[model samples]
Target: MLIPSAQTGLQKALLAIIAAGGVAPAEGADDSYIIEEIRAVGPGCPPGTFDFDAEGQHFVYDEMILWHPDPAGRTVQYTNCLTTIAIDVAEGIQVSVAHARARGHATLDPGIVARHTMKFFFAGDPSGAMSHTELTGPFDDDYDLSGQLSPGGEAWSTCGEPVVLGIDSSLQLNASHNPAGTAELSVDRLDMKIQARRC
Candidate 1:
């Protein structure tokens, strides 16, 4: 993870915390279409809490950043590719974490004011090969995010804020991107219950 040039330890602290937080993009303007944004919730440890010094572990990852200027003077666009390979505190610590990548973009009012949406993508859940963990596919859409879903029940709702599906099951996390373009999605938690475990 690339450390942000934030002033003050507390500011840096919060940025680190939010690095793994599940904050979605807030509402936007009339013509705006959120390509992607922060996750409202998920299971990856807080975004910026990588060092885990308190836990006595350290991990490093790769991040790709692209900056493109648009014709319009109002917004400067950017594309960010985040790739992470984590090393559990195995020798002394025990943390079964996963690697993740987020290749997304944003058109923003740059410099001091950042209005952007950042999407996240897993390499694919470690248990994805299993039948029980139908965690979804590349850009998993098994859980729907858009409020208005198609009645055909093509997929399940995963936006966390659940709707009754006859049975009461807490929602799950699913990743998706625009079929037409890129997007940013914020996920808060991915709670997995592996009762009958399989590799």
Candidate 2:
């Protein structure tokens, strides 16, 4: 129930953008993307408890990227890149990652890791009065698969630290408007640049 009580200006702006069919890539451009930026007032779950204020705090989803290309020309990707949840507080914030399985997916055992499992949901009141969305996942941030077999049985490996395999995170947003609206989001920014060539 960590949803926003009211629709912030940022939400409205984002709704407008989506309603307008979202941004499109430039004609014949090598790459294209969209950014959703907004500020809103909401409660923050900082470690233990949730807090709110009369003067809404600032929240930004600057990581909302609609689409981008893999520099290696492997494939076209569409993703909601990243997000930043900010609340007005006097001290620094400490956030921790939970080790669990994503919804609608198999549970994570002790030794096995989840490479990339995510679950997102958006719901609204039947009367279209309020709406909210949530995103959760358990991705393995330390699962390495270098020198792994490709789908086509070829040698294809990535050179890097163990990226997300199975990880877990939770975020919820509820608005007192447009209960029928739907939204999708990602937890944080992911660096997808190719560091080495087929390492």
Name the best candidate (by TM-score).
1
Report the C-alpha lDDT of model 2 over 1-199, residue by residue, as the tens digit: 1222232433443334334442222121111111122122122122222221222121223332211122433222233211122111112221111111222122222222222222111111011111122222222232211111112222211232221111112233221132232223233222211111223
lDDT of 2 at 35: 17
lDDT of 2 at 72: 37
In candidate 1 the C-alpha lDDT for residue 163 amounts to 16
Instruction: Quote each prediction's TM-score.
Output: 0.18, 0.16
Off by over 4 Å in 1: 1-76, 88-114, 118-122, 126-199
Listed per model in order, the count of residue pairs whose N, CA or C atoms clash below 3 Å is 30, 14
TM-score of the candidate numbered 2?
A: 0.16
Indicate the worst ten consecutive residues by lDDT in candidate 1.
Answer: 162-171
lDDT of each: 0.22, 0.22
- Residue-wise C-alpha lDDT for candidate 1, range 1-199, written one tens digit per residue: 1111212322233244345643333321211111122221112233553221211112221222222232333232333222222211112222221222222222322121222222221222211110111121223122211111112212222232211111001112222121223222222222221011011
